[model samples]
Target: MKTSRLSTALLIAYGIAILGFLYLPLVSVGLASISKARYLSFPIRKYAFGWYEDALTSDTVRDLLVISLKVAGVVTVASMVIGFFGALAFARYNWRFRKTYQKLILLPIFFPQTVLGLALLMWFNALGVVPSWKTAIIAHLVWIAPIATLVVSIRAFSFDAALEEAARDMGANQWQTLREVTIPLLMPGVTSAGLFAFLLSWGNFPLSLFSTGADSTLPEWLFAKMVSGYSPLVPTVGMLTVATSAVLVFGGLILAWAIRRLRPES
Candidate 1:
């Protein structure tokens, strides 16, 4: 009994240590954001919101934030729409070469971000299109859309095909059944997928680094600032990104849970 108790305590301590190792950087950045000093350091002498205030007051920061929002918004909408349609086709139907195509879906998820970014940069350049925010959106769409498809497809598979057949047997047309029955049932999954898309796009760094040629994104801007010098605003802006991602991811989880409650899988 004593040996078992000691082993359990050791496991708990190990888990906490691992968690702390992963989150310590974020905690440090949060502390730095509220530090009285300009540079990032531990055991900050005083706490203040001056860095956050300064970041908010900067016109450059504001513009970059706007660009990031716009890009993320566009990417979110586009990815969700594409993902939904792709899920419908892939999840609901099977045909020749479907297996081959399914394998292709996993490629983006497994591909190295830096390599993908560079490849996209080369593709755009070859077409004589300069790297711009639009290209970044396009690049992000490739990855996030697939993720959305995977998320929505899980729900799609859970959806009973019998309902649509029943609707047809009752003389309902395809479009009418889709509009009335399909969409309503799928709304929660679609919404949660969209939130994931937004979060992924908003926090993207490597692909944005390559595709956002002249236009600046928050990640790129933050990188530039960090390269120039160490300042509290760096951590402040990072904390903002962390907070936004946390809110969105958490909201998505809640939405997914509510969906399961409303439509429990049989």
Candidate 2:
């Protein structure tokens, strides 16, 4: 009993340590955001919210938010659709070149994002395509779609094929079986995949760095500001971005909970 209690105490301590490690930087950024001084210093002497207000009213900040939202929203939708079919193919259907196809689809995930972004940039140049938010979508898709597929594939692998077969046996056609049986079963995974895709795309920097030539997303704008000079608005905007992501994530969780509650018990 003593050993078990000691182990539990250690585990709790470890978990707290992990959470602190992960969120301490965010806490620092939050502090910097509220600092009233032109230069940031720890154990802040004065605090103010004016920088956040400045960020809110800045035209550049608004443009960055819009572009980031557009990119993330489109990527989320496309990732969900592509991931649904891809996960089915990956974990359900077995066909010729299945291994090869899986490897090819996932290859991009293994590549360094910086190198991948540069290669994508060169490819666009070769094709005489201009780099823009539209191209950034393609770049993000290359990296994010595979991750979405992997996410959904976890749920797909656990799916009971017998349920699908049972639907077919009950006089359902291919489309009907998919609609009534497969899709409903897979919806949870698809939703989770979309959440991952949106978050990843929203925070993506490397790929967006290369692909969004003239148009800048929030991260890109933040990077430019950081490199050029320190702006108090940087941390303010950072906190705002973090807040937006947190809201979306919490909203998704609440939505999922509501869905589970509303769903009829089988």
Q: How many clashes does each candidate structure show, in the order listed?
A: 0, 0
Give the worst 10-residue stretch by lDDT in candidate 2.
1-10
TM-scores for all predictions: 0.89, 0.95
What TM-score does candidate 1 reach?
0.89
Least lDDT summed over 10 consecutive residues: which range in candidate 1?
Answer: 257-266
**Angstrom error at residue 180, model 1:** 2.1
lDDT (Cα, tens digit) per residue for candidate 1, span 1-266: 35688899999999999999999888888888999987777789999998788888988778888999999999999877887877777687777877777788879999999999999999999999988898999999988999998888887888898888898899999899998778877676688789989988998899999999999888888898899977888888888888878887887788678767877473
Clashing pairs in 1: none
Error of 2 at 110 (Å): 0.5
Candidate 2: residue pairs that collide: none
The positional error of residue 57 in candidate 1, measured at the CA in angstroms, is: 2.0
lDDT of 2: 0.95
